[model samples]
Target: MENKNIEVKDENGNDDLYEHFRFLADKGQQPLRVDKYLMNRVENATRNKIQKAAKDGNIHINDVAVKSSYKVKPHDVITVLFEHPPYELLLTPENLPIDIVYEDDDVLVVNKEPGMVVHPGHGNYSGTLINALAYHFENLPNPAIINGVNNTNRPGLVHRIDKDTSGLLVVAKTDIAMTHLAKQFFNKTTEREYVALVWGAMEETEGTIEGHIGRHPKNRLQNTVYLNEDDLHKGKPAVTHYKILEKLGYVTLVSCRLETGRTHQIRVHMKHIGHTLFNDARYGGDAILKGTTFTKYKQFVDNCFKILPRQALHARTLGFIHPTTNEFMKFESPIPKDIQQCIEKWQKYSTHAEQ
Candidate 1:
């Protein structure tokens, strides 16, 4: 990786620029709506700027300034001129040890530990899987498909796991593998299983939750499903099937499978069914772990107002077809130490009632 210094001006003030843009158009095609096209291109750019740039003739479609609504064709040279923002600290490869469960020329699987973020974002900029992968593979493939013109720093990442949720993740080492794996994910052909520790024993041994998930209307940062049918935002359809594995008094250990992957799908669905994961403060598990000794020693617990630092969810098993080899592969990760300890502690304290 290389470092460069640049400057950009935003609403706040003059800031360093650290953004890149790539255009995808073919010759003889009408230009794409500049603002509409750019909305998909730049992740951090403001809509106003993107629109203004197009209106001001700063964007060229096939070397010609066009209206924002101009249609674009393939192979057309689309050029966007914008100020780059300052480079911020992002996930950089480090020598942090990782448990590699499976690896081949096209793909690699690793047992991700809890507390380790899959990628870097707000408030977290280092020690991520991306950083570790960069250090581990000298010539690692860039997994990100440059969609339209978006430029993100993440590379070799096919899927993601939350920072606090530990699990097994597959990384694509080649473009063919990346494409094939992404298709499986998009088509929901891949099989994924998770183990979660939730508060309260399940009344039923097995059940399925189906709902639409979107950002919570009242809470900007949280995701929720609307009870009302007339809400404008139609949440994407998400399904999760769960079976209780064991009961420890009030808490229950369960395994879940996803029919669709949406942001915070499992967590939100579990909470919706009145069984929030143990120690999950967001939905309503805060009271469950109150005064529990498990929080005394864990740094994550100490730092938060709540006990659990991350959601008690783990991606336990993943099975998919090999994109390159055409072979079916399945990978599984055991529960991480922290989650295991939490389960044990709960079992020790809670007197097992009749299951």
Candidate 2:
């Protein structure tokens, strides 16, 4: 077998990381159905997900796309491809402050700040969470070759959120932890929750949004929902459940729980139902989408936007089974001052409007 180690993505596929896998069967491997075989092995994958991958022509054997029912034989070379590209970064450790909500021998939970990028990428080569990890810790287990370069100081990240998003992230501190924690995320057994400030007052107190999300054809930076059955090729399945926390007239504060973490699941799904995230520039929530057309109202919103320049979203909660102890644990982070202050302004404004 060439490689058996797997990397996973958030069930809601986070952007900046397209997830893929390669599995080489052992010389003495027994015949088994592809989906079943894959379900037992791959990371961030489920039997249904594998079947979907097969249907999307993303599952291959010897470079040939195959059905989920295809039986695996000894020495079969299996490849699973998503829009995911290799995200290995050569670490340049930086001295940065990180909020550690909880830390154990197996894992560490970080309350990441909004402006901090999770890892290094094209334009951002420094001041990343990965860079900070390298500086603070001796090493995190990652034996895979990184972008055809040196693999030293590589941090193991089973899943990541967007750069502008702030949240609780669980980091693997050892090879054993990485494997066990990855399985939790892959099986969709972990619990995650987010708080968001979205435009427009929601008519429903709580609801679920389901759609296939893929990269936008025209706008490379954006993702759109593929609602039609034929458009499934464009994206993977994503599901989010949301409930209104407060109705702030023009915008509503909502709590979102992800079922399938695809890239930009909350942002795209909220916008699809006509409620874009407040100040989410890329998704068109930067401007006043549902407010009175007046100088006072516009100025008030502009001030709120200045307070929270990025998307009004925060990952408030994360829960998973402990890799070593096998006990379930959950962590929560308080909303940052920016989002909190902005929400306060909205609350005051909406109250006056109601009166």
Candidate 3:
């Protein structure tokens, strides 16, 4: 058999949960499905996650990316990659303040403040939520433990919100809890709601934005929605249901419920529909998207932007079934001061415009 060499990368800078695994197939090895081979070698790994990695082109043989059904041959060098890295080198605990919303033996819910990264990556190696968790707790659970390859468990992040988005996040403390919570997220049974102050009034009070989302080709920092038949396959299916909560003339406050939790789903979907989240610089919402170009109007909008320098999006509500108890649990977080001030400013401006 000819050896195939393929290079795979997650160029979106989503390296927070990245895990790398490698194995050398024995000379006596028989042809076997790559998924099963990995399951046996990678301890504590879930079959679902293994197949998902394969589907994402993260499974490679002899440096060649392969599918889940690829047959493993003798003397082949197999490698698998994943988003969830083991807790070790990056577990530098920091004595930062963490707002604990709820915690029990099995899980811990945190209302992560905006501007705090969920985990360390790139240049941010400390002052992250994981760092805070490490300081508060001993060893958390990492669901994917590949025996000798990354056999460490730390705080398990079932789902993560953006660094600039303030919201509730649940961390699993046990293997069973991590598995259960991850399944819920994968099955799309978990409820996630965000409140966003977007540019312009929405034409529809309630609607669903259905599109495929993937990393933008030109702008690596942003994700774009694919609605056309030809381009749809380039991205993954993502659905977002939204409703206008308040129409503030220039900018409308809306609530978005995600059916599929794609990266930057809300930001991309809202921008696709011509209502980008207010002050979201990456998606071109930082400048004045709505309102008159008068100097005073520009200053007012600029002041609002200054008030909420980051994206005007907040993860307000989260609901899911408890991994251990099987009881439905819900969490709500208040809009932080910056967002609140921005909204109030918009409320007053809209009222004045109406008058």
Candidate 4:
């Protein structure tokens, strides 16, 4: 059997648990029901899981949605998508406080704080937004049921943000709401703008960063942009439009709009152009990349790091069509206190240095 494994990054551009799989039947294969075929071929897969996937329109044959009973002929192409990792974790609700921006029967908007994991994953199995959501929305809608099987592990979560990135996120309260919001995100109809403080002043006041983003071949924990045309297909297209809002002496605060939400799009693109986000530990912005070689300046930089220990990124604005009412909705979040203080400290330091 011909097989291919693909890593499907979460649409929110941070989570890395979702996975997609594709298979091509061997030329000598006999006709078989698609769900039955998948159960036999996919390790740890059950008929109920396959049926649910088919019911949710997640199972496709030759790029078209198919039913569980659809016959898979020789050389037929098959594919399936999982919202979370294959390894199931016992989801337990915790009484964690979340900043609820707006809530309705169909959807809710949250102002996710810095250092909060959006969902439970590899190293984080608790104290996540999912756990908090589970606590709050205990009876949230479940996925499609087929043969008495339903995956209710992740309820109400439609998108996510990075743990260190503070921002606005929307959650769906029902399956229909989830599907509607998911389609909007997939079609790139949602509008998201982030405010970031980068290590250096930008040469241009406004510009667009265009590149294909993919996993770093050497470092599994990092993502890089592919500049070579031949290697473009190895990654996915990503675009970030940025405008400098303020140019501090050592760092610049900028507004970024995302056209395509590839993983780490803003962070990687800005780093590629030599303006990594301030205090972004993973992209090497935690160090003093730009500044004078003065003891006072070094001390000032250290103080700023203490003020905002994580990457200086905030999802300031989000816009999308309402899942239930079909009306366009938009939400804005102010920069967190830590980042605000960091900016104030830099402003004070810059003024002192000029004097």
Candidate 5:
């Protein structure tokens, strides 16, 4: 795998240096210290250069020359004059195996396996889906067009699934396809379905959950729904529909659909309904499925958990319109092996209980 050359152009056509200064000033309510702000905005730019630039009267605040300590206000415009640095893609491509469920010139649908990350990020710079795609599509035009402030590794990813959740994902190969797929997702025209083996038998066979989800105030890493109007973390509306496919005594196999995609919508909604997925550590589940009369089956369930590394949730299907042709496209992925084994063990245990 090799690193590719990439060019980052300021789409607004403003001077790069001046635009950077304006972006910092407008991003916050209070004025930013001149030396500190420039250092953060311009990568690898030296403090001496920044100070020199300020002293030379190359920086202006609200059309007037001001010192670095001058406070900024709302709608205030600040500009700085400086040279551009050589921009290059930081991530390199790597050869990794990917399951291609469906493919065409415009788009490709992948049945991603569990444990595979979608893109390279902190501490994970290789063996990602983006890296695999780069190797698979070596001749892709401008394969190195990094989004503004986004890493160069992921150029055509329209949507994402959790790294541990196995399922169908669509990747665009061309700009036209990318634009079309992005629009479908934005309009909520894309359909997504997930199959999960959730703990406890559901009381209701089918239902819909509607709520607003945002970052949890206490646990910054997780999202939680706010029930009050005064909550500072107001979230966007999310809707999820679910139906039980089968019930196996203590566990239920279910299918979920998303009307609005928010982070962890299905998982959170299920937890809200008091039916978290089996083996989901984040939500909570039975630590042990023991003490049952079916001793053999209980052992099987225990073994299943010991072997399975993540929650028993799978992205079963994805449907959307073709980005370039405007034609309907749909893809499905079978449940992964670990989840299937858990379901089988539950079925066996249920039959034993009946006897």
Candidate 6:
């Protein structure tokens, strides 16, 4: 049987479906940087965007992660993974309701819901944030257009969060706003904080995880943090600052601040340190990683999964300089109801364990 939705395992591992683009270089193809080669084949793709994808280990040649600078050879099979679907010229605007946290002429902050794909892709052609935005703003301009081509679907998207990870995200309304905001993200000046429930207690109250994050060598479906310095180019520099907010017997609630935004940075880095987010099935957190073997305990976890079907992660806060006014701006999102209920259940379980 074919899996209709492209399921991408989260770093900690809840199965979030994603779209992927695959290509094969013709035998007569000339050697060129992978990024440059991709721009021609990928609709509406810019060199910068392609390079960023390569740096994040989303670009592959014959199943091995490659850098943007890597030259593509004739008959070399290539693939690029996206959290969202590849750009198709036809982007139908759908009238989906969006939770607008704040909006102005220049920018808007949206509180994205869990299981909502940020943009439209292969299997998911409608009901995305982009589709909603296109309907809301009838004339929004595409941010990363190149060579007189524009991505009609992804207009105003400066950055993106995962499909299953609910959180706050900022969108640009104009070309100037998009350029300025994209620069902020590229320079690592933007601030993002996430709150997550992981399946273990931390030895330290607060610490930083620094590693190179890229695609898993074997598993093209997921990202992994490279530990060796020699393989740094294969991945990008990623830093996450975490503080334990609460200890719930077998699971811990953590506040994570991202210094550098790489794909799946927080989830993968947390798992790298042995603290996969609770119910993150991809990274082995879905099972009882640190809990008791008792049937009751197993039943309790199963119940939690029912309440929150995906990984326990959320984008709680976002801070950046206003593109128009250059003033500092920040926004926050409350924990979604499902995660709150899951945490409450853990709290009650911890209380009972103490007795």
Top candidate (TM-score): 6
lDDT (Cα atoms) of all candidates against the true structure:
0.69, 0.81, 0.81, 0.81, 0.70, 0.81
> Candidate 1: TM-score?
0.70
Error of 6 at 287 (Å): 1.5
Runs in model 5 deviating more than 4 A are 1-89, 139-153, 286-300
lDDT by residue (1-355, candidate 5, tens digit) is 1122222233355544332234324332445576655555453567787778778665566556667666656456556644442222344677789899988898889999888889765356677888788888854433332222233446667778877788999988887887677778878899999999887778898999888876554454457776575542346678899999998887899999999878778777887777877877765654543235666656766787876768888999999998767788888888888889888888887777779
Compared with the true structure, the alpha-carbon lDDT of candidate 2 equals 0.81
lDDT of 2 by residue, 222-339 (tens): 7889888766755778889999999999999999999877778999999999999999999999988998989999999999999999999999999999988889999899999999
Which ten contiguous residues of candidate 2 have the minimum total lDDT?
1-10
Q: Estimated TM-score per prediction? A: 0.70, 0.74, 0.76, 0.75, 0.71, 0.76
The lDDT of model 3 is 0.81
Error of 6 at 191 (Å): 1.3
Error of 1 at 272 (Å): 0.5
Give the local distance difference test score of model 6.
0.81
- Runs in model 4 deviating more than 4 A are 1-87, 142-153
Alpha-carbon RMSD, candidate 5: 8.1
Stronger candidate by TM-score (3 vs 6): 6
lDDT by residue for model 6 over 263-303, one digit each (tens)?
77888999999999888877777888897889998899999
Give me the displacement of residue 7 in model 5, in angstroms: 11
Tell me the TM-score of model 2.
0.74
| Residue 60 in model 5: lDDT | 65
